[model samples]
Target: MGEHRDDLPLVLLIHGFPEYWWAWRNQIQTIADAGYEVAAIDQRGIAGSDKTPNSSDALTLAQDISAIARSLGASRIVVVGHGRGGQLAWAAPALAPGMVEGVLTFSAPHARAIQRPGTHLTLRTWRHVLTTFVPPLARRGLTDPVSLEHLLAEWSAPGNDGASSQAQIYAAAMRLPEAAGISLDQLRWSYTAVQRPTGRRYFELTKNAIEVPVWSVRGQLDPLLPERAWRQDHTFTTGNFRQITVANSGHFIPEEVPEESSQIILEFLHHVAHQA
Candidate 1:
């Protein structure tokens, strides 16, 4: 809870879907060692954090991050979001502009609403819809450590190309019995809330470009967020931004290449500090 360095700023990390604060364990240590306070939180319904019934929408999730930042006595924070967390990170700064100093995301697109029709419609989103519609089954599968482990493993190794050892480690984390603590309704809420209001309310206020510095990191081999999304989002930012692609890494950039990710983050912070 203590800020790492008196002179350095704080880093607020938001973990991706199905992952807890542990996702940033290595990054936190590395960043903290460099004299920055790191506050990595378990997003809603993922861990011990608030499991609000029916609360998986991106807007609500963004609010959760804001609340966490305020609770830590930070008026503004450098937000680092991974995967789904990145999406929320994109939206949060818009809703609470004064509370965010900068935005750094890995594998997350901008806050634009996902078009329901056409090729852009992905199987992954359908899976989320199914889970949202049927809480009991989705909750059952998500809470089952074994099932969750398998899901994370599959996510890590798309088409059997990823490292088996890494996949096993991710799977093991999901399989922990503690995964069953969150209720089915809570898990379902986490997904459904985002699709509500046609996914427009949150982005409407964010339509104007964000003025904060932004960094979007991508893995060269990541299957979750293809290069196409990155290209489309490249032109959407409002302020100064940078996009870096991590070689040979996948969606799990922090887990796959902690040093490279840390280096990129460190350099960005240093640049931001000098500009300030």
Candidate 2:
């Protein structure tokens, strides 16, 4: 909330599903102006990024995140994500523990927690069930502006109309050729991917691999990923993680509350800097 007294570390933002770099357009400059080097990229398979539709699982996405950090030539980095990207933000620390200085997530639970056994607290209105199970139908019908609008509206706490700058960007991105496949891969693999031997081990091993401090930001208005998930924050990782719930916002907290989101991030970054 206050002006950053010292420059923070490099912070790379990864956007949620059905969106691109433009989704973070509102928060980018604001966070950058607070004295940290910042960059938000289109995750692979959407918008301007490459499309490895079949291979776009969370672990691979986390790899892309680490590679992006190295490409940017930053030594100490902080990873932030929203929605599906939030899952990757959780994995980034495990993938690049030494390189990542901090981890921050919005609108998503930690990957391992959601994938762990005996955990069945899904949000009230997760459209992912339909999207992942009925990919063909979802792809055929969801790209239409009306359907996209409905999807975003249901997910938002305040009910977005798919017209805000952020929602508009998502509406356009979800219509891309690779978008449907990417969306399906995201949630489908979220749990299924962990079923494989390698994935099962990755999920278990990384629970404690994330030693860097983390900040899990949630939208109080989120319909699909609501306050219930916050109860499991302690299970996200064995790292130092805290939760901050934003009001008057839904799944698209960054879009709806850019100023507040930026301040929360700056405060967290500053706190991490002082601790180091």
Candidate 3:
């Protein structure tokens, strides 16, 4: 969304489940105006992006982020994401260290942290994860405007004025052919892949601590991933790692608090630049 400059670092903004590039509508220009170039993409099967079913595993998804940065002529990149997208950002540095210089994630924990024994995922989160196992039902719920609206409202902080508008946009995008199904498939892989050989390989590859700087932000009121889920994330990074909890915010950190989120992101970007 901003001009690509040789001197300016490229920031790739990735949206999470039930969201696309529009999720970053508020922050795109803000980051660009701060002297950075940004690209907010519709990951894999969401929105207008190609629907590649059965190929949305962690490895493939992280590769997609690296591929996009290279295509954008970025020598080094900062990847920012929310929700599931944030999880991917956590893995990108390990999977593509040459391309990724830093990561800033909103409401996402490290992949290993989520998979550890006794991980603290809320009941609502488990319900959402289980729903993906039922393809037909999950697809329908994701595409239905009423259902989508309810889910967004349930996850967002109280008094969030943008929830309804965000739900409408995401619901419309899900109605695209195969979008809902593919989105569910991505979620399904996140859980079920651990049982497969490929998933084992992925974990092994990312087992070592990430070498790039990482900044993770989450809402104190986030129901899906509570404080316990993210507390150990600092252990996953060998480089600079910082975690911030925003009071009065929920799962939808970026949309719920765009101004504060942008400031946090810009702060991380400046930190990365200084370290480099």
Candidate 4:
């Protein structure tokens, strides 16, 4: 967490699955030192946030971000997210136009890009996605520190010595009452949303090009998302957009390469500030 100043731009950091506000521990101070206010939040139903059953749909989650921004007294904010959180960041401008000044996403592509014809999910990614639908299996996996550690090691770039410790922390968080269930619910909704009317409306609303500036970053070694998932994302943005690949990194770019991530974020913040 950083000081909130009305004059300074608010950078809202939203974490992906199996992570809470602590996910941004590496970037928070760096951003604050650069003269920006930062707020890394634990999305609803995870960590300290309330567990509102069945409210993990895209529309609801986006609304939560908007509400948090407003509550923080921010007229506009730069949203930074990873994985599923990145998907929500992509949706923010469309769901709450004028509320988001810019977006910086890590390891996640635009929703349309993911749904585009011929796009495919890697087997590793599919395994995690499928686990969400199986409650017992999902819970078991999340609650076991060893399983989480294995996942982190698999998903992260080689030689990430901190992955095991991070997994232990995440495993402990997941053991909180109902936290595992909520996390699974969020993933489950992502997979089955297409069959629901609300999900259809959500996609429709975001069908148009994003008018705000966007920066998409991914680790070069990330196996979860292929290049095809985000290579053509420029077509979905009518405003300024850029794609960056961090060499030797993996799915968890923020933690895998904090210095580089911080540098990229600072550059984006400078761009957004000058653009405004």
* lDDT per residue (tens digit) for residues 76-132 in model 3: 899999999999898888888777889999999988888887858999999988888
Q: List candidate 2 stretches off by more than 4 Å.
A: 1-7, 117-127, 159-168, 236-239
Indicate the worst ten consecutive residues by lDDT in candidate 4: 1-10
Per-residue CA lDDT of candidate 1, range 83-158, in tens? 8788778877777877777888987777463332344434664575576566556655555556665665555525
Output the worst ten-in-a-row residue range by lDDT, candidate 1. 157-166
TM-score of each: 0.80, 0.88, 0.95, 0.95
Stretches > 4 Å off in candidate 1: 1-3, 113-137, 157-195
Of 1 and 4, the candidate ahead on TM-score is 4
Cα shift from native, residue 29, model 2 (Å): 0.7
Query: 73-146, model 2: which lDDT tens digit per residue?
Result: 77778888998898888888778868888888988887655655553455454446655688777775456666
What candidate 4 gets wrong by more than 4 Å, as runs, is: 1-5, 117-119
lDDT, model 3, position 131: 80
What is the per-residue lDDT of model 4 for residues 241-265, given as tens digits with 9 covering 90 to 100?
9999999888888988889999999
Model 2 scores what on Cα lDDT? 0.73
> What is the Cα root-mean-square deviation between model 2 and the actual structure?
3.1
